[model samples]
Structures are given as structure tokens and as C-alpha cells.
Target: MNPVFKEFKEFVNKGNVIELAVGVVIGGAFGKIVTSLVNDIIMPPIGALDRTDLSGLFISLNGTFYQTIKQAKDAGAPTLNYGLFLNSILDFLIVSASIFLLTRAFIRFQKRQVEAENADKICPYCISKISINAIRCPQCTSILEETH
Candidate 1:
């Protein structure tokens, strides 16, 4: 194999690298789902309630009136698309909240796993931490009798 190809294979074979690639793919798909949710499900009722089309709300800088953003852009007019900006901001907030919740859940799970592995008892011989279910002190190799 070519040196560059061999190096690339090794890099791709790493577990974390594969996991990261899967995460990026899933994140991109999640973004599209959120975007569709915002545009289709959330925005219509919101726009109706506000008595304004959220996506169409923009200020024409060229002093030309246009019914839609497409018309304005097609006419070669500059516009401040604050409505699109607002939509993007909403998308960012949703994604951020989702990532935060996922991270929090992952942390809680890790804590549970650690707790199951490490316990409150200190081994008398070595003064090292051991699991509640342990039959022996791992550090000192001292046999233990269940107090309970």
C-alpha cells in the first residue's frame, strides 16, 4: 500500500474516529429534521398568530416594494433578511438545548457506572476504595466479610 493510503487507513480504523464520523452524520441529519420542524410545523401557526409571515418578513434596502424575498432578490435588490436570521437563531437554540440535555444524561449515566464500580468503604489494609459487592480488597488483596 502507498504510505499515504496506509496512514489514512490507520487513522480511519481508530474507534474514536469512526464514532466521530457517525456523530457528524447523525448531527447533520438531526439539523435537517430541526430545520423542517421549524419551517413547517412551528413557524406557520406562529406567523398566523403574529399576523405576519415569518420567512417573508424582511426590509428592502433599495426602497423597492416586493411581495416576497424571492422577488426582491430576483430584482437585484439588497435586503436585510432579519426573518431568516431569526429562524436560524431559533434553530441554533434548539440544537444547543438538545446537545445540553444529551450531555447531561450521558454524565448522569457515567456517574451511575462509576458508583457501581467504586463504593464508600475504605479497605482497612490499604485504605483504598472498593465496591460494595466486592468479596476482597482489590488493592490490598485482603479477604472481606460482608458487614450487612
Candidate 2:
């Protein structure tokens, strides 16, 4: 095989490349779900209670009062959609919090794994970490008790 292809194969075999790609795909789908939750489910009740549509909440630059964004756009007027900006801010906060929680959980899991691996015995004489299965301390060459 070619050297470049061999190196590429090694890189792909490292596992994280595929996982990262999958994460990206899943993250995109999650973003869509959050967007739908905010726009379709969460905003409707708030809009109803306030007696106004959240999506249409905007300010027209043409100094004309419009009931909805549709009216402003129909008149060829530019608008500042502060409501949409607020929605985007909410989405960002939700995603960041979720990612932070996931990262914390992953770190905790990694620490548990490290502690499990460190369950090996420590040599009494030299105080060096040794395998639990060791019959003698490899560092100090001291005899160790048997497992029976």
C-alpha cells in the first residue's frame, strides 16, 4: 500500500475520527430538535399568554407600526428581529449546558476507570505501585505474600 494511504488507515483506525463524525451528525439533529422545541412547543404558550406571536416580534426601520413581521416585510421594510435573537440565545444556553453536563459525566467516568486501574497493590517495603498479581516487588525485589 502507499505510505499516505497506510498513514490514513492508521489515523482512521484510532477510533475517535469516526466517533467525532457521528457526534457532529447527532449534534446537528439535536440542534434541530431544540429549535423545534423552542419555536413550536415552548414559544406558542408564551405567545398566547402575551396575546402576540413571538416569531413576528420585530421593529421596522421605516418608522411604521406593523402588527407582524409579515406586514413589515410585505411593505419592503427592514426589521430588527429581537425575538428571534432571544430565541437563538436561549438555544445557545441550552446546548452549552447540555455539553457541559456531558463533559463532566465523561470526565467522572474516566476518573473511575483510572482509579480502577490503580487498584494494584503498593509494595510495603519500597512503597512502589505494583501489580496485584505480583509475587514479589519488582522495584525493591522484596518477597510478597501469595494470593492462595
Clashes of 1: 0
lDDT of 1 by residue, 1-148 (tens): 8999989888888548978989999999999998998899888899889798777889999999999999999999999999999999989988899899999999999999887665567777788877777789988899988864
- Candidate 1, residue 119: the lDDT equals 59
- Each candidate: what lDDT? 0.88, 0.88
Which ranges in model 2 have alpha carbons more than 4 Å from their true place? Answer: 1-17, 48-52, 122-148
User: Worst lDDT window (10 residues) for model 2?
Assistant: 50-59
Q: List runs of model 1 lying over 4 Å from the truth.
A: 120-148
20-118, model 2: which lDDT tens digit per residue?
Answer: 999999999999998888888888898889787666779999899998888898999999999888889878888888889999999999999998887
